[model samples]
Target: MKSVQKIMPDMRHFEPLPDMDDRQFQQWNALLESRTGSTLPLERKTFLVTNLGMRMREIGCRSYDEYFSMLEGMEGLREWNILVDRITVHETRFFRHPMSLDLVKEYVDSKPHDVDTGKISMQVWSVACSTGEEAYSLAMVVDQAFKKRGDESYFGVTATDISPASLNTGRKGIYSERRIKEMDASLRKEYFTPLSQGEYEINEYLRKRICFARMNVLDIDKEPVGKMDIIYCQNLLIYFERSSRHDIVKNMARHLLPGGLLILGSGELLNLDCPELEKINNLRVLAYRRVKEPNKDQN
Candidate 1:
């Protein structure tokens, strides 16, 4: 179970928040969809009720309707951010999905040497990277591939999420020993510094290669991030309506440079018909490759 962080009210006493009715649930679901492009299905009513009840208690709001009313207009924006942070899933670890990471490593390893710079220059984006594990995992694989080839490649990762709290944790680049236990001993030793406690901090070399930012997927197209060689967006679109998922994927496809890779959680979407991309045929992975840039000399 995902733990909900508490934001306690200053008051000494308060009544219990009222249970959310069907109408109230609809109202809350619609608001979430409008703001974040994520929808809460009926089965998640208990999850919604639990998280909302805690937030309501923090503000001493008694009724769901009253709390819903408070979330109106610009005044409610800050509270929404807090609510989003509490509700979004952040259960991830280093190399959580080995198959996806393997595909990423394979792609990087196959790249031919750059003719001009004599090194591969790669840009990667980790969409909805909660607490930085996925972003850092990507950096590890890319960096290792470059080292294996004995080349000084230029690579950077941009990690984005909507939750400020999660981004803050990611920026610190610190993790408990349990969080990194599954990582290979050699990689862990090479990339992390032992801290005072059992926690470890990512080495400066890898930390400096990633940039973490706050972004709402609904506003993805407006963000100024340029093209990327790899865009990893896993475990995100499952919360969105099907149409919204398609729209989001289409916009992400636009961010991919020619021959760039787009990886998603297996079964997140099937038959994504993007004219600029072709589906990668792997039963163990969900990925697509944008059409390779044409060779000028051949023309």
Candidate 2:
């Protein structure tokens, strides 16, 4: 009887509250729209509320109402950013998408081998680089490519994100055994060292090549880290509203050097407002190249 009771389900349980009230739903949608230039469906709203509500509990907040109220006050923006950062899924790993890295390798190979010009050197930015996997992967690629080419120095990669906790984890460069299984065997051997049972540490060489920073994409006055050769803003733009998307796109364009490449997530697209960029290939992996000179004829 006791064993059967342990196996059986407990019948007594409280019903969950609906994810959000109509007003709360509207507020969440508005906030999403304002930040990402993207619209949220009712389903997504429910999902965000349910998931984010649970996430708030981790921070000791009992309900979404309190969380929302905290976000609305004067110091709310900072907290809001932190909340978003926490709730936003960082579903990424080393070389999760191989084609993008291949494109980068091609670009680097095509460049002239003149150290003096500095034009031959490359600057790559991995915006929203979660867990440092993407950044480290990039570093390994560039380092190998440069070594193969007999070049003394490799390209630099800057990885940025809004979450301090995520950034800290990324900096540590230690991942569980399951995470490393996704990497190619050669790269796995080359870039990681077994730290302990079911854990690995990123190679020091790869770690030194990439710099991580805390950055919010919405900041208008964001100065370019430097003139960049390739900007990988993958899996990030889908969260923003149309205006915010346009603003961030424009800022990214501004940061890119003439003929530099901008890579976005599969779902993102450039609008007419961004006239300086021309789309390349009608594929989900849409690539944008900055025009050598902005067309004065078109506004």
Please give, for residues 180-231, the per-residue lDDT of candidate 1 as tens digits: 9989999999999999889999999999999999999899999999889999
**Would you give me the overall lDDT of model 2?**
0.75
By summed lDDT, the worst window of 10 consecutive residues in model 2 runs over: 9-18
Please state every model's RMSD to the true fold in angstroms.
Answer: 5.8, 5.4
- The digit string of per-residue lDDT tens for model 2 on 1-299 reads 55554565432223344457788778877775565345567767656866676566556665667777788856897777667664566888878778878877777777675556554577889988977888887787777777777865557889998777788888999999898897778878988899878899988878877888888777634655777888888777876755677678888887787778888877675553787788867464767888888564132
- Give the whole-model CA lDDT for all candidates, comma-separated: 0.89, 0.75
Determine the C-alpha RMSD for candidate 1 after optimal superposition of all C-alphas. Answer: 5.8
Q: Model 2: how far is 258 from its true place, Å?
A: 1.7
Q: What's model 1's overall lDDT?
A: 0.89
TM-scores for every predicted model: 0.91, 0.82
